[model samples]
Target: MLHLITYKYNFIPAGEQALHIVFPEQINISENQLIQELASQLRDSYEDEITDIAPAYRTLTVYFDIRKTNYFKFSNKLKKFLVNYTLEKKNTYGRTFEIPVCYDLEFGIDLADVASFGKLSIPELIEIHSSTRYFIYMMGFLPGFAFMGNVPDQIAMARLEVPRSSIAPGSVAIAGKQAGIYPVASPGGWRILGRTPVTLYTPDNPLPPFQAGDSIKFKQITRADYEAIKELDAHGEYQLKVL
Candidate 1:
């Protein structure tokens, strides 16, 4: 007999037209997968009534059309479909991305500060960060800004008390348990330790490069490699490796 796993979730009204379907407030992969599956089920069942479905760490916010469907109608519709829904049987280990990050002083202004704060050498800090594979929990703050998780406790630090006015694009930063790249030149408070040459935000591409439930590994590179990749990337010739 095939054993099936069904998870329970909560559907709460976020706004007049938005509903938030949430799993337990934790950072487990199973909870994230359940949230993703819930978003998937909603799209499959209510394709016309739903305008947008956004998944986060443990919650999936569904935006619906008020003119066509309200909370009462939506809940009833979900109950019917969810009873028959089963989790997909496939690999969810997630893709491993070899993102090239340049840790030179020019790109990583806060490298020394972060290293000093962690009571480690710059090389030690980079090695620890590069070796660990990070999980993609959610994408938020800005388009393509992926909120990845579980920065090794040794180097994890709190966000800056005062945020910078503007941070350069491609800056790889970490604060608390989360790490992310600044997809655009935006104001931020995270501790920047390096920068990747890869372009994260692609408006022309329908789907963003990174999605929730993905994984990332940073590969250390020199400044020369960063310049080379940047040039090729500008011409649309560079391709990032995924394993």
Candidate 2:
């Protein structure tokens, strides 16, 4: 028996050529996965009409060619598609990446503050943060910035009240239940926990290796290890490990 996936969702016009399929507001793995799957299916099913599809935490923004399909026709098609959509159970899991992060004071400026907030030792805080394989709910803000989630409640710090002028690339951060990395040396604010040595983005190759629906696991490393990996990555000799 085919189990039809059903969830409450609504369509909202973004512009003349685009529209958003919005789901319930929440950061959830199952919901995000559904959005990702829907995006994939839409691309495959309506490739001629769709120019791009971006999946976020609980929304999929679809950009279609106005010449090929108007909002009313496209939305009606999407409604029909949703009525028959069923997810492939076997392909539920996304790719998993093991990224290295160093929680040294110089890189993690807000580390002590987060630890204090959680009433945990720095080591304990690092342990909790690194233990979980965070799910990638979306990728935005920068080319390689992945919005991942469900930071352990013990250290789920909120974002800084004042935005930072600039944030270094590879900075690992947490905001409430979300975790993320700075892909380049530009930012507003998110509580910094550590920094990764891997080069997340480069001008030559703007697109990231991973995509939304993937998973990221941060491995705690020493400062020396961070420097070593940084050198290797800069020279293009290092590759991020994926599981």
Candidate 3:
């Protein structure tokens, strides 16, 4: 049976322990914002019963304790609350951060290829990329890998035709409309343009420093600057300012 909560969503059970609130099939900024707000409301209201509330691109997962609340009663109550939920007129602009990146060939193996693909000079590509402020749409695919969006059209290009076996940790790359840094060494397809020296994830911190809805700006630096920051980062002395 199809259970529609509103014109924009349908609620489906994800087993006896959770429910998935799905939005429109298409990916849009407004739809994502709506999901974020809805997930925030669920967490605020049902903190005791909910074990977790996670929002992805367009779906909100509400995880609850089966021992504390049955799916039937809990889902019904959630549906009713959502039916009356109103998205606030004022937008919540999350924290802004500036990440330092060094785009020298030594760190950016695919830089030449990416520049050629975009029909841009290496300097031109870096200028366009660093000038734009990106929005953090979601953080997944790996721990602390922020899925930021809206890379400039001039520099926006498709991912590599073939995925690389592995990319270095802190490698900054872009694919489609999104850009992100590899927090750990792993296989990926995104075209590499640069690398940041910041440590985005660590066992010492339970959660990543940034969250979804945050804004990020890429600040370009010289290769010398990258090495300096890298040394500080390695020794736990580098500090990234958040506004």
lDDT of 1: 0.83
lDDT of 2 by residue, 1-243 (tens): 223345788999999999999999998888888788778889999999999999999889999999999999999999888888887543355888999999999999999999999999999999999999898889888888999988988899899999899999899999999999998988667999899999888889887788887899999999999999999998999998998
Counted clashes in each candidate structure: 0, 0, 0
Query: Which ranges in model 2 have alpha carbons more than 4 Å from their true place?
Result: 1-5, 89-92
- Give the TM-score of each candidate: 0.87, 0.95, 0.90
Which candidate leads in lDDT?
2
Best by TM-score: 2
TM-score of 1: 0.87
Q: Model 3: which ten-residue window has the lowest total lDDT?
A: 1-10
Model 3: per-residue lDDT, tens digit, 1-243?
112343477789999999998877754555677777778878889999999988888788899999999889899999898777776543555888889999989888888887887898999888888998887878788988888877877778889888999999889999978888999899999989999988887778635677888878889999999999999989989888786
lDDT (CA) per prediction: 0.83, 0.89, 0.83
Per-residue error for 242 in candidate 3, Å, reads 2.4
